[model samples]
Target chain A: SQTIHQWPATLVQPVGSPLSLECTVEGTSNPNLYWYRQAAGRGLQLLFYSIGIDQISSEVPQNLSASRPQDRQFILSSKKLLLSDSGFYLCAWSVQSYTEAFFGQGTRLTVV
Target chain B: TQLLEQSPQFLSIQEGENLTVYCNSSSVFSSLQWYRQEPGEGPVLLVTVVTGGEVKKLKRLTFQFGDARKDSSLHITAAQPGDTGLYLCAGKNGSSNTGKLIFGQGTTLQVKP
Candidate 1:
């Protein structure tokens, strides 16, 4: 069984502070990874996706970046956090591009 | 701009009632997926419709894809309080295999007991 783990179930950070959110997958190899952010009770917005290590694509221009250092590990980081960066961040993995994705518990970040 | 438009952003119905949620888009999708999300949690996959005019059923839930492959719907029969949650529709572009998904605004369903 494949599972995803995202740390810091909740976070509160001050503006201009550095941010780092980590996600890792177990029981799978070379799976497609994705980062998504959702507003309160709304749909998710794709932030970044990686097919493999060193290969990442950004869906929108924003105050964030993603890195895939290992096959099953993805990290989302920001140099300076903003108030608008507060949201529910989710990490997911899939066997293929068009397959069902399994998600983590998610991290809720509140930028103060 | 939102590529997919979901209707009835909020719905409240009684148990045993039936309801339908619609997700429409102008662009073609190779696959359309439906997910249900609870507060403070990640969305869970309910169904994925790939072929045009495809229909699939899961217990009391029925999923239908538009004939044009640009829209989809979810119908729940005899809605229960357990069915209350936020529903989201996502689409994968047919033109590319990037695997990136575009999501709709989402519909919040509340089934009152």
Candidate 2:
């Protein structure tokens, strides 16, 4: 079975600080990875998706960026955090296009 | 960009009651998925409907995809407290094969015990 692991299940950071969230998938190779953010009581918004290593497509433009350093490792980073960056960040993986996506436990980020 | 719209942003019902939530879109989708999300956790896939006019049942949940592949609905029979969560509908963009998904605003369902 494939599993996705996300670090720092919960994070609290001061404004203007740097943010780094990591997601790694085990038991799957060359899987499609995605980054999504969900606001309080709101639906998720896709931030970035990668098809392969070093290839990322961003859905929305904001203070965050994504990188696929390895086939199973994906990272979301921000040079400087903003108050609006506070939300629940989720990492998901899928075997192929138009398939069901499996998600990680997620990380709750609060930028104070 | 493809857009999915879900109705009844918030629903509160008692256990054993029946309720239905609708997801509609103007653009056709190659596939559609429904997810249930609990508080503090990621959304989990409940069901996926691929074919037009497809109907899938999972326990007490019945999901239907429109014949035109542009809409879908979820019907719960005799809902239980465990069914309370945020329901999200996502569609695979027809123009993209990279697995890009467009999500609806979501419907928050609360089944009181």
Report the number of the highest-TM-score candidate. Answer: 2
lDDT of 2 by residue, A4-93 (tens): 999889999999999999999999899999999998777889999999999999988899999999999999999999999999999999
Residue A83, candidate 2: how far off, in angstroms?
0.6
Per-model clash counts, in order, read 0, 0
lDDT of 1 by residue, B1-113 (tens): 43999999999999999999999998888999999999988889999999999999999999999999999999999999999999999998876565778889899999999
Instruction: Kindly list the per-residue Cα lDDT of model 1 for residues A1-112, writing each as its tens digit.
Output: 8889998899999999999999999998989999999998888899999999999999899999999999999999999999999999999988866657778889999999
DockQ of each: 0.70, 0.78
TM-score of each: 0.97, 0.98
lDDT of 2 by residue, B6-88 (tens): 99999999999999999999999989999999999999999999999999999999999999999999999999999999999
lDDT of 2: 0.94
Worst 10 residues of 1 chain B by lDDT: B92-101
Q: Which candidate has the highest lDDT of all?
A: 2
Q: How much DockQ does model 2 earn?
A: 0.78
